[model samples]
Target: MTDSDVTISMFERIGGSATIDRLVDRFYDRMDTLPEAKMIRAMHADDLGLIRDVLKRYLTEWTGGPRLYTPEKGHPRLRQRHFGFAIGDAERDAWLLCMRGAMEETVTDGAARQDLNKAISGLADWMRNRT
Candidate 1:
């Protein structure tokens, strides 16, 4: 199959919200535990429940599922939202490391994992507020 055929919506490819839930859950769990992710994890609050929901909703809309984020949070001005944080190369790389580990633990399909990684890389790069 061509790339287009292989390119399923992040929702369908990930088995819907259930899979997303698992992915996000495992992601936070890893972030909470991994040494390499310590810096990024420190940025977040002690409570990860709300953040997890936000991520799920945001990803839901982002992956061509539903427009939950836009409706609830308005436009996703990700860079603006992240501007308060010091997102230098180190921070960005750390975030990517955490996300990559999460993806590996959660995603099973090769194409879907690659697509999510590419999109995440772009988003992480965009979230950079510093060098």
Candidate 2:
């Protein structure tokens, strides 16, 4: 196929497993330490290990690398799963703050980073359950 005919998944564009891992790690690191993320951080377990792995797999699958998430977790009904949390605009912003910082630190490609940021920002917005 010609170069223009080739379609690269966002996963590949962002450097696959390694980048996803770093992104998730950085995201949680920010949540674990940032003052602004305190409310949302409180919703998570003190031990971030399990969620970290889950995010890695979810991001991997979401970005089109491999079916690392759904094969085990089924379709990511992310909003439904998060319904118990009191997610509001502030919570969404806090999440975006962490995710944006993580994307900046981990994702090297500018275009890919921007795309991921937009998509993830949408997701964070979507997760809001409160007005």
Candidate 3:
């Protein structure tokens, strides 16, 4: 098999759009309910609808599924967009708690889950703008 044939995108391995939606929903749900997520959840608006959709699209595209986020929103520029938020270690850890919980509930495959966790952990850590 060629590289293209052997290489499967995390998006595909994670079950494409349907699973992405589920993961996003679970992530937000965890954030909404978990005490560990209170700090990060407070940074979000009262209504999570918009961010939920945006994240679904972003994760879809980020995992090599489709170009759903960039065409409308332009570059992700994640850190720049998040600059207004004071994301210290506590905030990052809080965010990761929600995300990791979501991943545990959604991504069944062990390798895919680990890969996603590492990538998301890196992203959450990068969002930290404070000491």
Give the winner by lDDT: 2
**Pairing residues by index, what is the TM-score of model 1?**
0.90
Error of 3 at 27 (Å): 0.5
lDDT, candidate 2, 19-91, per-residue tens = 9999999999999999999999999998999999999999999999889999999999999999999999999
lDDT of 3: 0.93
lDDT string, candidate 1, 1-131, tens digits: 77777756878886677778888888889889989889899999999999999998998888878787898899888888877789988888988887888889888888889988999899888888876
Listed in order, each prediction's TM-score against the native is 0.90, 0.97, 0.95
2 or 3: which has the higher TM-score?
Answer: 2
Worst 10 residues of 3 by lDDT: 1-10
Give per-residue lDDT, candidate 3, residue 87. 92
lDDT for every model?
Answer: 0.86, 0.95, 0.93
Ordered from best to worst TM-score, the candidate numbers read: 2, 3, 1
lDDT of 3 by residue, 1-131 (tens): 67777888999988899989999999999999999889889999999999999999999999999999999999999999999999999999988988888999999889999998999998888888999
Candidate 1: residue pairs that collide: none
In model 3, pairs of residues that clash are none
lDDT, residue 21, model 2:
94
